[model samples]
Target: MGRGYLTKEMKILVTGGAGFIGSSFVRCFMEKRQNPVVTLDSLTYAGNMANLEAVLGLPRHTFVKGDICDPSAVDFAMKGVGAVVHFAAETHVDRSIDDSGIFLRTNVVGTGVLLDAARRHNVKKFVHVSTDEVYGAVLEGYSTEGGHLHPNSPYSASKAASDLLALSYHATYGLPVVVTRCSNNFGPYQFPEKLIPLFISNALEDKPLPVYGDGLYVRDWIYVDDHSRAVDRVLWDGRAGEVYNIGGTKDKANLEITDFILNKLGKPASLKKHVQDRPGHDRRYAMDSSKIEKELGWRAECNFEEALAQTIEWYRSNQGWWRTIKSGEYRNYYEKFFAGRLAGSSAGSVN
Candidate 1:
């Protein structure tokens, strides 16, 4: 219900635009251009309305609460949209480990529905959001765009399936599809269940900071805004039927990051609690993002230290936003995942 600067050819349909990275992209895309955006989300537990409060009532931005697997719902949102940016998926590794049915249904079947709708509706572009974890653990070198997909967890496997499904459309049916695989994203508005935000929320309340196994698991971290910009670049500049990798260029161990957070918050290192590692937890993930960097001139511009500090500050100021979520099923899940895992360990576990 708002005026927009985009023409008839620029209207975009963004699925899962209410989640962390999706919301960031929606805001960035709107701010960068006057494109009219129609966001379709299922309003799941992790999809919070507060994330889009900034642009909820803005001109040319609309929100539709619906599932991506619903063909009628997808067709409704795709009416005037020229492009589709897919961000909807069951993304949590732990949750997928617990129950993978929803992940496969949402990530695979939902993507199928979206691809069909885009093909039928003559959408100009389809940017499918994916993760670098689909490449599994990179012990030595970085994962290139064409790296073998050895997804170690249900969550990543579902995404990999979706990735292949999207590319198939481009190859078999000539759908203009582009896939983007991004590394770990940490920034403001992330759910309290993610590693960075979870540790921060627990630390604020003087709770134990759970560290998985030896805590040497390494991951490349990218700021959510930087990721959003990268996605936008792919949407506008990437070639059809190609894949791009987006990386933060900064790799840090889990233990190092948790300690840094505690130190930054003026908390003690004594809060470190080592728990049993989840099954099939990938030890490391690296990305060779040169494709996106060289092709679209999109590089992650946020420094890790600066962005981490900024994220911590945002959590400090936005207690009301996270306090509500942390007080819900997340608390129970945290207890089950961490406390339960460590309950039988000796005192050495708290080191």
Candidate 2:
């Protein structure tokens, strides 16, 4: 077995650690290992400091507020780091469609900045966290790591470009970059903008659950913790310059998930409002995870319905956490984006 990098005692950096998935990784790593972790995040609309409340005060955990595109910030956070798990980027497809400049600058340019810093620091490993959306819609079968990338959205396009750039660093400069693209992630502390949490919160409030098009779009759902564990495997034992696909193996349609959330919350089917679909919406996304499972002996452990039930419970118990988010800028975006479609369905705005 090839030990790609990092001893048990070395320090690691987790970019965007204050966000949903990154925070999960930080908490998971801090609890299970002795290594110190340095977190860097700029606290965007989606990035919340409260997400890291579990491990903020831990002795080995350090938080830095900075952007990845800033070379100075990247350098400061790169010091004494043996590995980097980069999760920082603009991830929302709707927002990317609204404007793609930020995605390109942050996802592509920022990744370049981080890769250069890692090379200069001689970091033992660079784990480039990515999404399966880079493969676009897998209309049939599953997309393997070696499959061709056919990104359909501005967000996925930026990620595809960044993935190539990360691999280029490994090929050109021997940066030990290993990219892992995972399916849709859902769990506690996720922003309400995503499908699972969005519908869960909306169901809780009796707000109309906006269903895009026919709501039959399919996506492979992986619990955020499971995805975090896969990244951990890749970070430690994954061979350099390789791409691994992580999937939950639980594929569900949008309306099927909506029905589950409505039933779970005791809400009626009346709240589901069919809305015009967004442009370039992929019909389905599926990925083959045999590489990660066979190579690193890692597979998603959480059952979809069970993990989703737990996720709903988390949102139910933590209303204040999500309320604060929905009451802020997200509310404005929601109203502007969905108000036209969601109007006359009991509420005029998300608030």
Candidate 3:
């Protein structure tokens, strides 16, 4: 929470700064670090300006509407920026299965464009926000930063491709690039389509809780704020051209998570409904974050249970915010974005 490491004059450009995790980073940088931040977001379905309302009038903050794949826009944003935090991507797994073209275009091609701009401008650092999904499913042990990438879905594959592209620039052009792959993050302002938020929203409305398959798949849950803090650490002291794994060290099965949500919402257990599991669903995922902890002295400080409760409370208090997002018009947006796509037909499959 201390601002000992960041300088007040540091200027940073954050792509995808209006989305869930990106928005959290923007808020943290503006309020906690007191650094000058310029945010670029394409205003996709998931990106909302309402998330940044708190810092809208701050002099040190600026927001631009642009695409990361456009060299001109990337170049314009990179000028005089000390660092680049790349978070722009097509991130939904189900949507990736439906249509991978956008995923490839934005996640892969967009990263290349940003890297080129950063290299040309000689930015001090380029931090790429990634996901543990790049490592695919973990049958047994946890995956470390050195683990081989075996991305299973179009979304993960796109991210893996971007990670490689960023590192390639670092290796070939000596660009200061660093990558951080984090576990599942849940917190306030998350879009309702994601698992945690979707379930929370439905449960609050007394709707059926959709459980894919038997709901045995497992994943590590990290509070969004804690993940944001880890990002700050990597930006400050993390080694260049290195990959760091950030995890909460808390693993929960999908069924357990569903039960927790039901209990938190005071919903009946009978609301749980079994549905057909998506094809090639990864069985489990875990992360070994010792590298970051030992090297950068970073660890997740938020308690998962408490954070989950707080998130539920946030949704309860902010019903109007999500109600507008769940209207019939939003359903039309979903259909247009993912029309004529099968659940399991994609170029990438989990290993």
Q: Rank the candidates by lDDT, best first.
A: 2, 1, 3
Q: How well is each residue in 1-351 modelled by candidate 1, as lDDT tens digits? A: 211122444889888887899999998988888788898887678887678877877768877767889888788778878889999998899999999999999999999999999988888889999999999999999999988999999999999999999999999998889999999999988988899999998999999999999999999999999999998888887888999999999999999899989999999999999999989999999999999888899999999999999999999899878997877744454344235433341211111
lDDT of each residue in 1-351, candidate 2, tens digit only: 236658987889899887899999999988888898999886678888678878876778887767899898888788899999999999899999999999999999999999999999999899999999999998899999999999999999999999999999999998899999999999999988988899999999989999999999999999999999999999889999999999999999999999999988899999999999999999999999999999999989998899998999999999988998988854464335343543342211111
252-305 in candidate 3: lDDT tens per residue?
998998999999889999989999998779999999999999998999999999
- TM-score per prediction, in order, is 0.91, 0.93, 0.91
RMSD of 1: 9.8
lDDT of all predictions = 0.88, 0.89, 0.86
Q: Which stretches of candidate 2 lie over 4 Å from their true place?
A: 329-351
| Count of clashing pairs, candidate 1 | 0
- Model 3 is weakest, by summed lDDT over 10 consecutive residues, at 342-351
- Candidate number achieving the greatest TM-score relative to the actual structure: 2
Candidate 2 collision pairs: none
Instruction: Quote the positional error of residue 242 for candidate 1 in Å.
Output: 0.2
- What residue pairs clash in candidate 1, if any at all? none
